[model samples]
Target: MNTFQFPMKMVKRQVYDRIAVQDQISKTELLQEMDITSSSLNRILDELVREGWISESGQGQSTGGRRPTLYRIDPTHRYILGLEISRVYSVLGLYDLQMNTIASYRWFMDEHMTPERLVDYVEERIDWMLNDYQLTWSQIIGIGIGAVGPLDREKGIILNPVYFPANGWKNVAICQMLNERTGLMAVLENGANTALIGEHWAVRDENMQHMLFVNVGAGIRSAMMSGGQLVRGAVDREGSIGQMIIQTDGERLHDQGNYGALEAFASVQALEQQVRQRMKLGMDIWEAAEDLRPEQVHFDTLITGLNQGNIFLQELFARSAGYMGIGLANIIHILLPEKVILGGALINANPSYYEQAIAVARKKVGYDDSYQPIFSKGVLQERAVAVGAAVMILQQMEL
Candidate 1:
């Protein structure tokens, strides 16, 4: 059966989504939760099962007279492809209906990687993954890409992404290209926004109505969810917080040429650049790692230096954390989300950095107890963007 040919009715889609999230739900429970009539609910359930989207899992405990039949999304019925594209690397994964990663792969993004080349690489990898898993293309419901932007999300195009080397990549219709190659529905979204969706679904916190997700990796970006909906601004660049100026005299980031931007002071790229600059001045920044040259310095090297008692690295991280705190404080003052989730390679590599940033953020908030927000680390780690991309596709699906 075609994966996307499932029930299209809003009620039916709701039923499938509910069962997908709850894992298993009794017919009686679904009846109570959904506003449809008993006959209508039964008809929808029948259609879902007929379409291979759901199955009668088993019987549930009896409330009084008779046991109710339990329904669950068929995990093997369909699959989703999630791709996360960054300036440094890309990640791709195949996820089951329940958002479990069946398989995943990561590859570095070279400067020569143009839009066509990137699409070709992804298509090849996707074919291999499908073959390895003994799955067919028909089973793939869709493909979702989490990419750097300013994107034209509605057009499914990548528009002049900062730091991307290939000049031809500008105005690339990524979704159309992938769709043509793979014969699957494709979507493109900002990496940070996709990460936020992934975190929200993974956490499954029903009470989380407002949230802020900060990604502090090669560059800093954020996504906000207010009142259970993503706050995509008029141009869908609402969460491009990296461009927010944090200091009047801070160094400019090379990509956007935005002076004193939050990313300039807090991103992994910023940290590495600072280390490189210090090395040029004859500082022993590479003392922790033997044979590591100044030009070879990267985020991982700095993380290693910090772990090995490098005083300079420690001070650098502390200072970066302070800047991050200030940036987060500004975000809080504007958004005032109930929870702020911090994630990225740097934050995940060292929890202390996030803690330090949160400490400073709390201090900056001052005596405003009403402005308190729960600051926490992201749960999905490296897979957040990929999984979130797939989840976004799933969310848009009718079933």
Candidate 2:
């Protein structure tokens, strides 16, 4: 763990966390809370104010001599663009300096399975979104991209993204490319981390310092937050939990290198595959799914049937939830987050589907209500990653 001195990164984060609470914070209280001398803290606050990232909000009640000034982040001093890139769609949103979403747009692509298509798809949406908002490029302080990994954050590239090779984006420099194309600064991060940041910043819980971001969709990952900062351990490969072997002897594939992993059971592709395999056995899930739209399988139908007490669907979901529980239990034992926030399509399709899994996790975690970890759905819902990306830009400004 990195130690903190006065006028350092940790001190700044401490101040921001406090300011984040009351929408504004007083200087004396912050200095006292952070255990920093007034002179040093004032110097740092002055730098922050001069940067236009923070401003005086109001006068606080006088202690004895003079009333102290309250400071808050400049809500419109700058803006951030949060771009969430997925295999199916790209969601973009603009946020004021205070991490509030001002505008957003969702763009879908038929074939973003390659680097060129991926880049083009993002560039197009970014151009249209900025134009529609009538905001000059200069107003955008920074851009943050939430994407699938294993990624090269330094290089700003997705490294061999699974199932999307044709998009011409294997090792593609997403940050540099977007920076050059849009003339804005950019940071690339894991989708799970983005979602986690969204959840963390949204809850207004500065005290809930440690938590886990469990994304359950096309894949499953675990992003851990400890002591306020994200723990991207050892080369930014912290949350790649898709391949944790949950079953010793299950159907195996030579796909992403982990045999019979949780992804093989819980991912959207896995769910679709289960439906397809059931179809071969005289159970046509396509009919049960009630999918009419072209190229769009109705996952909601599966969820509906599971909710309405379809035995076969229930069994399928139970087993999938079991795998999810296995994954969650492993994460709980290892990282021990205070809470686990679930995100992604599979979880959103039917949160009930994962209830059995949570039960199983509870069994493994034993009983402890005081510091027990509770599982909850992400507050941002579908927009979690995008919003997190925007929040990332705001945080990067060191506000």
TM-score of 1: 0.92
Winning candidate number (TM-score): 1
Tens-place lDDT per residue, model 2, 143-197, is 8999978788878888876644145657778898888877889999988889888
Per-residue lDDT tens digits for candidate 1, residues 367-397, read 6766699888867878999999999998887
Q: Which ten residues in a row have the lowest lDDT in candidate 1?
A: 1-10
Q: All candidates' TM-scores?
A: 0.92, 0.83
True-vs-predicted CA distance for residue 281, candidate 1, Å: 3.1
TM-score of candidate 2 against the unseen true structure: 0.83
